[model samples]
Target: MSYPRLAGKRILVTEADAFMGPMLCQVLARHGAEVIADAGTLADDPQRPAAIVAAAGTIDVLVANLAIPAPSTPAVEVSEAEWRATFAALVDPLPRLVGAVLPQMLARRSGKILLMGSASALRGMRRASTYSAARGAQLAYIQAVGVEVAPYNVQVNAIAQNFVDNPTYFPPEVQADPRFQDRLRREVPLGRLVTAGEDAEFAAFLASDAADHFVGQVFPVCGGWVGR
Candidate 1:
């Protein structure tokens, strides 16, 4: 199906080599968006997000696709370093990226910022304290920023997703495991992993003009995993 929802729009997708980045760029481009895929990490170097936005120049949409390998340490065993690192990787770069692009969007009185967040924040998960906390911070930031910028015609929202088909979280080897299949049937109401294309298409809709009415909203794309 042809969706020219984002025709003539320039979108900047961060962490373009990882997480939802690869699929998001492909899908947005298919929807007629000019995607600026930046395969750079925003951790440690605080200046990186701004640098990426500055380089992209005049972006109509910002896809914050930040991610890291989720650490599975138990809550009691999660160290301070683990906590800090997880936040740095998944949470810290958010504001910096928004800060960079928001000025332009606010000035122009038009823009969209879609965060590829996680459902782990909305639902409880064993051995994911640090990772879940960081993801939670991301959603909260989106909610606050979404409302703050909505009046300027700049919408900020998030896709809090899990159980999606992607190399980062659900790689081939993992999906091939029978235990994983059993888990899917037992946990996810959809009884399957949500395809990358399905998730990205929704993201394309959110980034387009069609989704302007939505603000400070968290859309869960977890194949109904969060519902259970």
Candidate 2:
């Protein structure tokens, strides 16, 4: 539970009230990180990311915890508004966040940037065209920027995940439903949901010095549901 490498580390997690935010903050703090949990909206203003970084001051790690409700509209019915909105919520802020934080990290030549992304980008899902596209954009951005930042020893990576127990995706009510449980067993090779704590632990590891060798990696954390 203790990560000396993360002890005294300053980490900023966006949307801290949703989608792995609370658990991430709790785990990182338990491991001795100075977690700045920002439960705020970013897409409302392109400048919000930079403002957050400035407010948080010295950031050793940035967890871009972005999320929007997945659209269930069929591909043909997916409107331009939905598509643009999804990207605005999920894709646009990534560069802004990195732009805001990279200078400090690059100056020190040490920092971690971890994106909380979705496996829908890695695999196809029914009724998720807009969400999948946005998630895919996030993965691509991470891969490209991860390498770009590596020369400065600032690692960038993403946790491409789904089927995790989180309020944003799978809530207790959904888990308790028999149909969802049956589908979960059929779909997820693990035969159960990955706990938020487990996912947060992985995020904590990635933020620690132990993950220095990783760069441009889109790690799939959806149990056996997503691979390669």
Candidate 3:
């Protein structure tokens, strides 16, 4: 029950200002972890690792949460240039950051890396094909690297969240629209949106010994949206 219990542990989180990141940091600190958050959006001028590496010493945990939503339109309507940028912004940076710190952790033989993924990886989201595709690639990458790092006492896993009620990821119009809300309410068995704090708590557990058995896994944090 008291999982996070991350007292004195140092954790690094990217996209600290996003809907879920800061909230997650608070939860980590509440569990006694020393949270270090900085501006590390994959789209930022200087990437995540650059900022994170500069913030402090080597990290005990890393949370990679970056996403780039391509323009909503048919896949046939998307341009090549736009698609390339989306792939880089969504799929590339997280791995680079992980690769950067993973060796250090492996050498020490103790670390947890929780990368943020989406339920869209299960099946593509209607208009957000690019985001889905990028995440799919991310899912594959995490699995491979997770296997390689597990032997070194490093843990890697992805958390796939469905539709969480957050302004940064969801538009204000959509958030307040009762028609759209009712539609999603019917889709998810929980009949409501996933809260960031709840997701953070689960993530904190993954970052702790509580989730030692969770390796190379895609833990669906969605409220039955990606399953029956």
Q: For every model shown, what is its TM-score relative to the native structure?
A: 0.98, 0.97, 0.91
Model 1 quality (TM-score): 0.98
For candidate 3, the lDDT comes to: 0.78
lDDT of 1 at 105: 94
Cα lDDT of model 2 by residue, 130-167, tens digit: 99999999999999999998999999999999999899
Tell me which residue pairs clash in candidate 2.
none
Off by over 4 Å in 1: 226-228
Worst 10 residues of 2 by lDDT: 219-228
**Number of the predicted model whose TM-score against the real structure is largest:** 1
How do the residues 114-189 of candidate 1 rate in per-residue lDDT, one tens digit apiece? Answer: 9999999997888998999999999999999999988999999999999999889999999999999999999888
Highest lDDT: give the candidate number. Answer: 1
Q: Arrange candidates by lDDT, highest first: which order? A: 1, 2, 3
Steric overlap count per candidate = 0, 0, 0
For candidate 2, the lDDT comes to: 0.92
Higher TM-score: candidate 2 or 3? 2
Error in Å for residue 221 of model 3: 1.4
Model 2 deviation from the true structure expressed as Cα RMSD, one decimal place = 1.5
Instruction: Give Cα-based local distance difference scores for all models.
Output: 0.93, 0.92, 0.78
Clashing pairs in 3: none
